[model samples]
Target: MKKAVGIDLGGTYIKAGLVDENGKIIKKQQFPTLAEKNDREIVLTQIEKSIEFAFEDNIEGIGVGTPGVVDDEGIVYEAPNLPCWDKINLKKIFEEKFKKKVVVENDVNTIAWGEYLFGAGKGSKTMICITLGTGLGGGIVKDGKLLRGGKYSAVEIGHIPIDYKGPKCKCGNIGCIERFVGRDYIVERAIKGIREGKKTKIYELVNGDLDKITPKTISDAYNLGDEFAESIWIDVGICLGAMFSGLVNLLNPDTIIIGGGISQAGKILFDTIEKTIKERAMKILSRDLKVVPAGLGIDAGIVSAGALIFQE
Candidate 1:
């Protein structure tokens, strides 16, 4: 069985694993990214350490999933939280260090490929996957291939604008879907309701500390039978579904996979997204569409990173 070292690089931690070709993780561990130091070399050393931790003599190579826009040659651009990361040739760096073949891709794109191969999207001809959390990231698998641009990982789905005149996103785009559904924005909605005295359990869950309110708090409130909390997830789902409706029209994907922290809202969120997409997208395109949770679970990143190298 062929194996590889997989590295999932994040702002706060680097998750490393030894994975077989079948997408099963044989062993895995986590290391702090130490991105707070804001030194590129420090972060690089951390990644190297992660690679070493997972490396084995018989492994085929290393696969890295990093947060950034990665070009065809594995040159990373616009990496957030990692200082001086722009224009770094990650593939070249790691290959030289480890003396092995290396494959690097944007983290979300890696996840989409993993789902396509071993998770919810396994049997689908076309699939779209997104991770909803502090920020929204997405990838697409079309016709049994991971979609990519001519020279870069181009499926930047989160940056797609839903409203050109609405609030500006952190990416400098106005009214991107992420601006309305990202973590802070979701929490902002709950804060507004509390300030307006809407009388909900969210306030109680946070003990009046508006700053402490999170999507989890809202989920907890909804579990306690709070209608107001349910409203927040519904609105978020609507925002996401509205964006996905456009994607469905353009891509005609058969499956849409949702993951990451906020996806834990479970039934209410998924149901609302499916309902809204059905209502908004073209009937022919939306009819067979299935919105499902990601199948890779908590270790998706590590497994997906390995999948990058094991692609058929």
Candidate 2:
């Protein structure tokens, strides 16, 4: 079988894997991004070293999934987390450095493709995959093709405007989905609820350290039957469902795959999202829609990036 190399580049870590045609990762490794020690050449060198460690004679191609808005032409327009990345042709850099066919895409898009081909959305003709992490992001695959808009920002569900008078996002948009569902906002909501005397275990769990509070704190508290925690997830699900209703109505995908950190909320989170979808979306549009968790977990990025080469 053919083989390829996949790289998932993020702000804190750079991961690389050797993958076979069947989506099995034969080898994988990760390294610190050293972003604080940032230098374009140094960062590229680290990535090169990882790729080289994974390379072998049979490796035919390479694929990368990065944390930014990547054009179809493999240029990173902007990566919010990576302060130095802007209009860089990463594909060219990797290809020239490695002398292999290299392809690069937005990280979320790669995750969606990974799930569609090998994880939750497999066998579906059309699918939408959303990742709820520090930010909200998504991608859509329709009739076996990934959707890339003219600006390579198609299906970027994070910026979908839901409220007119809501808080402004760093992206300069009012009421973007990320403003409501992002990690910072989720924690912010929990903190707000606690300050207002809503009953929850988050404060105690964090040992009175608000800065240490995280999404996991909220999830753990919810599992412990905390009212405030439960409310937060419920509200998140409702907002997500409301935002997704418009997509379902327009795209009519067969399934929706959700990934990233917040997906771990399990039933408390998914049940509400499912219920809201049923309530908000049109009957026919949502009747058979499957709201499923991503099956690959952390490996989704590596596998999907490899898929770019594996499929070719």
* Best-matching candidate per lDDT: 1
lDDT of 2 by residue, 217-301 (tens): 9999888888888899999999999998889899888999999998888887888888998898899999999899998877888
Task: Give the top-scoring candidate (TM-score).
Answer: 1
Q: Please give me the total number of clashing residue pairs in predicted model 1.
A: 0
TM-score for predicted model 1 compared with the true structure: 0.98
Q: Which stretches of candidate 2 lie over 4 Å from their true place?
A: none
For candidate 1, write residues 1-312 as lDDT tens digits. 999999999988999999999999999999999999877898899999999999999999999999989999999998766767889999999999999999999999999999998899998999999999998999999888899999999888889999989999888879999899889999999999988989999988878899999899999999999999999999999999999999999989999999999999999999999999999999999999999999999999999999888876
| lDDT for each candidate structure | 0.93, 0.87
TM-score of each: 0.98, 0.96
Error of 1 at 96 (Å): 1.1
lDDT comparing candidate 2 with the true structure:
0.87
lDDT of residue 124 for candidate 1: 95
Which runs in model 1 stand beyond 4 Å of their true positions?
none
